[model samples]
Target: MARPRKPLLSRDRIVTTALALIDEEGLAALSTRRLAAELGVSGPSLYNHFATKEAILDAAADTVVGRVDLSMFRDGRDWRGALLAWGRSYRAALTEHPRLVPYLAVGPGLRPAGLRMADAVFGGMVEAGWPPAQATRIGALMRYFVTGSALGSFAAGFVGDAAAYDPADYPHLGQAHLLARHREQVDEGAFETGLRALVDGLALQYAELGAGKDDAQGGAKGAAAE
Candidate 1:
């Protein structure tokens, strides 16, 4: 008896295949047919795993995030170091797949892996003495900065690309970029510096909050005695 047709495909396989195609041809060239061909499967078979190319791309994005090893944070390093490391790792993943950077640059669906990373970052912020609401907001800002830096770095490296970003119009930014021309303008150095600055700022905020809480508790005790 002929062996039943092997279950030939799965979502993970499809996402991995899609990412490979994206790495090869870029976001513009990715399509359901292209992905299926790359995976050695028929186009229709893709639908069983992903509803559309967008869905596949979304899955691929999440797959990239899912690959991150968050053990640095788990090992009890200070939040500053952990956050900087996380940002560096995230940027590295996107940088490795330059074509995938554009898709990540856009608004995409959040996946379980992305949510887990977000939770970890937010939890770290809270452990560092931030209020829940403040921690979430700060987490969003950090994400924005890291993503923006990655996209900018990728865009700058595009061959024959002009700085169409007229720094002339923004004197301060233009001057800053020009001044940093001699430095390693990559994401790692910038991410670490920015991350440390944020952590230092947060430290001041935390101290203020701690002082406020202590004052309030002391006031309550004094009032009880009076």
Candidate 2:
């Protein structure tokens, strides 16, 4: 048999096709057989690129993470500003792949792109004067908030029917029916609000640490004078 004129498969092609499958049919629809069929290749050909289905899923998930804007971290941007930008980008990327959030959340991020994201976030925080431990916690905190937001449908869960909430029993929820109508706006607003609060809280903590350091330095100076 003659060698093929064109390449049959590549890692990028595999991951991209897997992502398309997930985007169109949800994660459950992705399988080696289905992907191979989609790629116009035999199922065994996929194994040459990815060791297993889980490996392919991990690559797909990392590809989504790769879409996030991390440039803010490279330009000497203030910590809070960079973090806020990264958070919004992260959330937006994950929001587009809401079905994959669950898988991305639990993984160890063994892929190169995912590991680079982790490094940027952690290094950015430390460079911004956060203790290593605190920086780690902050990264985890953002991941938790963003991933949880991706999974939750506040509008869908809200009782949109007035009949569902009796005024006598639930006075506060009487106007809750309107919440469902503004799902997109409400969800985006809530995410932004929470992102601001988180960033502001971290900033305050950083300020307090600075103050503590100043106080300690002043105390040492007074002792030297005595």
Evaluate all candidate structures by whole-model CA lDDT and list the values in order: 0.74, 0.89
Question: Model 1, stretches more than 4 Å misplaced?
Answer: 1-10, 105-110, 154-187
Best by lDDT: 2
Model 1 score (lDDT): 0.74
Model 1 per-residue lDDT tens digits across residues 168-223 = 76554443434334334544666667778877887787789899999999999999
Write down the TM-score for model 2: 0.90
Residue 184 error, candidate 1, Å: 5.4
- Model 2: per-residue lDDT, tens digit, 1-226? 9999978899999998988888788889999999999999999999998999999998899889888899998999999999899989998999888878888888445887788888899999899888999999988998888888887678767877889889889988887888889899889999999999999998899999999999999999999999
Pick out the ten consecutive residues of candidate 2 with the lowest summed lDDT: 106-115
Deviation in angstroms for 50 in model 2?
A: 1.1
Residue pairs with backbone overlap in model 1: none
TM per candidate comes to: 0.75, 0.90
> In model 2, where do residues sit more than 4 Å from their true spots?
1-5
Candidate 1 — number of clashing residue pairs?
A: 0
